[model samples]
Target: MNLPATGRRVLVSGASRGLGRAVAQAFATNGDRVAVHYGSREDEARATLDSLAGTGHVLVGGDLSDAAGAASIAGRAADGLGGIDVLVNNAAVNLPHPLATTEYKQWAALWQQHVSVNLLATANLCHLAARRMIDAGTGGRIVNIGSRGAFRGEPDHPAYGATKAAVHALGQSLAVSLAPYGIGVASVAPGFFDTERVAHRLSGTEGEAIRAQSPFGRVASAEEIAAAVLWLASPSAEWASGAVLDLNGASHLRT
Candidate 1:
């Protein structure tokens, strides 16, 4: 099938595995110069990099928890690619801590990681990237990956849900704030996904229980979510800024 032809330059965070890897591959397949960023898991990141479709793939690594580091990462990518035309904020964490067991210490740690990777770091990159686009007088797209657990509730991971909610909100805020600079922002939230990393989180009974709620009786694949993201960043979605495309399979919808 013919997919949307991606932009010339793209930066995808958390691109070593899961949904991030899927997204990076999708863009690469469609002819985008993709910079794959990884927080850890150097081997996995490299594996994904080697597996991409385009020769323009580059592997970049940095701990995104630091605001300065995040900005610097953006700068490096812009310099390497001459300028980044697309930024995909897909790195995330969901440390499981129920409200009952959640203490300020745990909450703070989880909050820091989730907020930094999911929101703060993303915003930092967006801030820098938007300026680059503005200076070039060319518009760009920022696509963020969020979670359905945020809008509803993830019984075991309060930090994940809260941070994703913030991500959702940030997308909208950036849409209006960055539009003047000719930048667009949007989010894609996927429900209970069947990813390699999620093996422990949703296995045996737990996985089956969650899958029951999905009308399709299954979790979504990384490619499914990636396709939605591709469509969002495609030229067709240029006029679709501020959209939060849902890939929940009607599981979260209450009739």
Candidate 2:
């Protein structure tokens, strides 16, 4: 298959593993220079970097919980890749915090952690990246990895759901706010994916129930989500800005 013809400077956050790793590989395979960003897994991040098909791929590390560090990631990537043409905000946490079962204090702590990494950090990156893109006067693309739970609901991880919904909203708001500067912002809302983190669940007794959620009897693959992200980041997809493209397999439908 023909990779993207245009060689863009792409930065993918949380590229240490799973879906983020796949997204980075997709961009690199398509002839783009990639900056692989990781929060805590430097080894895995380097593995992702080395797995890329092309040259000029670099590994970036930072704690997403730190607002300053999150903002710095964009600049570091720009420096590493020469300039960033696409930014993929994929770093996130999905810790369980079921309101019905958790104490108020614990729930509050989880909420703070979720908000700091998923929303605040993501917002800061968007801001810094948009500014850089604007200053360059060159068009760019931003693809955020949201979740179907944002709409369908995540009772166990309400903060995750809420933040993802906000992320989708933030993308739409930035799409309009940054259009004049030639920056296109969009998001992908994916259902449960077959990543290392969820392998156990996918293979356990609950696995059948999970698969039954979709008629296809399967969950999404990292590559599948990566493809959607690549399309959204493509120049041809500029018209899709502000769109929250759903990657769920009819498991959760919204009006």
Candidate 3:
């Protein structure tokens, strides 16, 4: 199965802003049609759609925390893009839930939320899109946005860390399972990146420390991570399937 170099149908979840937006833009600029999925940011999603470099981009909105919603999201994206050649599972919930300071109720709820959005939704969409690809007889790619915290740990956001680890593992498993179908699967585990949601944390003392985490003395730009994601989804990256590429700038090395 030969994947097209451009003009592929791509679906990017949580594309209303930040990393999602960058990924969408990258694909769009590469001449692919994108289905930009958002949870509750229709206006921002439209902004993403409008900012695309080419035509055929569409907006898809649905709650990713619900199973039905995940199905709907995949269905709509497939319909909008005509078909899905690439699925980028980037939507996630990452609220802080330090075990010691958080109450049981809140901790449990956050864990559930993170699992639903970060892990389960991704699994569901992968199944949905992979089915479509198999039916169409078109090989595809799946690029999951994991996190460096999965390896280094997230003391303040245990659930986020745990779910991302699951995401990485899922991508590897699917990479093997889907290879027979000509579908490549991979993941990107990014460390600190500058985005609107975390802009505040990148300033003052906190910003200094965050930058210090990387030997480069700087956090990554969303575009840098997006570029890696774009490559992993490309036709040349099929051999990279089942690999979790680390983009941490030497912050935390895994030997």
Q: In candidate 3, residue 137 scores what lDDT?
A: 84
How many residue pairs collide in each prediction?
0, 0, 0
Q: What are the clashing pairs of model 1?
A: none
lDDT of 1 at 53: 92
Candidate 3: residue 75 lDDT (0-100): 91
TM-score of each: 0.93, 0.97, 0.99
Q: Which candidate is the best by lDDT?
A: 3
TM-score-sorted candidate list, best first: 3, 2, 1
Off by over 4 Å in 1: 1-7
Residue-level lDDT tens digits of model 2 in 1-255: 111446988989899999999999999999999999999899999999999998999888998788789777877899998887888999999999998899999999999999998999889888887787887778799999999999999999999999999999999999999888888899999998899999999987799899889888899999999999999999788889999999989998899
RMSD per prediction, one decimal? 2.9, 2.5, 0.6
In model 3, the runs with Cα more than 4 Å from the true position are: none
lDDT of 3 by residue, 127-191 (tens): 99999988888799999999999999999999999999999999999999999999999999999
Clashing pairs in 3: none
> Global lDDT for candidate 3?
0.95
Best by TM-score: 3
**Where in model 2 is the C-alpha error above 4 Å?**
1-5
